[model samples]
Target: MLLESLSPLSGMINLVLVLLSVLTSAFTAAVGVGGGVLMIMALAQVMPAAALIPVHGMVQLGSNVGRTAMTWRHVNRAMLAAFLPGVVLGALAAAWLLVRLPAGVLELSIAAFVLFTCWGPGLPKRALGRGGILIVGAVTTLLSSLVGASGPVVAAFIKQSQEGRLAKVATFSACMLLQHLSKAFVFGVAGFVFRDWLPLMLVMVAAGFVGTWLGLRLLHWLPEHRFDNLFKWALTLLALRLVWLGGQRLAGAG
Candidate 1:
């Protein structure tokens, strides 16, 4: 019975999803990006009934909070201070103003936005102080609000730092937590059902804890270049897939 419950493709895939949560959480911890975003996409394919943003938001909240706890020493308070205001602004919009965007259209546009961010040549690798941080927070929060999670974008900004693994993880986790908080608040205000999601999120959180541990352990053995390249390709693939999904949704909308 226990072995039956542990299967990855069977009734226990939710459990496996939880494990994926853990692994991706650790991935974010180790590489400073890609926590719930990957898990959310995978879950979307498997759990078609789930509401994408809020469901993933709570899980992400749990994952990043855990990562931040583990890597708290490396957090960049100065950076967070600058970016937070913009995030709050975006959250308010998501909660109050943008509730009715046509589903597929919004997703496709967001997918395109992410692709542009990924392929665009103009983004700065680093920025400091209130101005830079606010811009980062605003842009990332806006994108995240629409698309559930955009760990890669946030990482693009954070990865420019010279901070090593733990620091990168800590600071990135802090930023994501704030973003997820904003999202949860917005979704709650928008009247998405939540009571049922609580139990599922709890499971995902547990999985995220273990996944993060493993990802961190793996990072210790892998060369830095290999890790970076892997993450880069991962984001690229995620963006492309989202773009296709979004486009199909757009076609359906029309």
Candidate 2:
């Protein structure tokens, strides 16, 4: 039964991923972002392309749920309310279009935006308001549907907000929970078989919760100034990685 549930992955590989989920979840919980991007990148190495996004979404949904539950008090309720509509809009748009963009172009676009958001001038207050968050919801969800990890983009946008570290992490996790939830629905409607992957996903999510608990403790210990620097550098590195990937893809295509 265990082997059957894991399907294509061998027992050893399944074990490895479960362990990785804990580490990656902790990293994201402590750092306030980048964990999902790291998780998806690792998944891509071992998972079939067709199963990658949906599986990643399912796992991430669980991880974010853990984080959100632990930090629910810190979430920005008003922002979350605004972002929900966008999630619906974006999911509907993705389901309606059902087209994949050229991966290279999408990667490059996302990378550039992440870099600019990290280093560029801060967005005006107006652009970070309810209207802006709604737009962010739609665009990030659509991009996430295509690319599998829009966490960086969403984190970048949330980084612009004036919320404290805990609030930012909490709210980001809440937003991601919604995005991943929408993703599951979209993929289910498209006829992906999630049941075959359920056992592994369940174990991974449980591991991620353990990691989230540890990470939140670390988050409490870290100095605020250090966290700000770490968060920016972490985003910068992830964006650079995206740039490298995009370049490789375009070059290969050329």
Count of steric clashes across candidates, in order: 6, 0
Model 2 C-alpha lDDT per residue in residues 161-218, reported as the tens digit of each score: 8468898799999999999999888898888999878888999999999999999999
Name the top lDDT candidate.
Answer: 2
- Tens-digit lDDT track of model 1 for 41-134: 6877865443777778888888878777776777887877777897898787766665556756655555565555556663454554567778
For model 1, which pairs clash? 22-207, 22-208, 22-211, 22-212, 23-211, 26-212
lDDT of 1 at 176: 89
Candidate 2 error regions (>4 Å): 1-5
Give the range where candidate 1 is weakest over 10 consecutive residues by summed lDDT.
Answer: 2-11
The regions of model 1 sitting more than 4 angstroms off are: 1-13, 46-50, 99-129, 161-163, 246-254
Error of 1 at 45 (Å): 3.0
Predicted candidate 1: what Cα RMSD to the true structure? 4.1
Candidate 1 lDDT (Cα, 0 to 1): 0.69
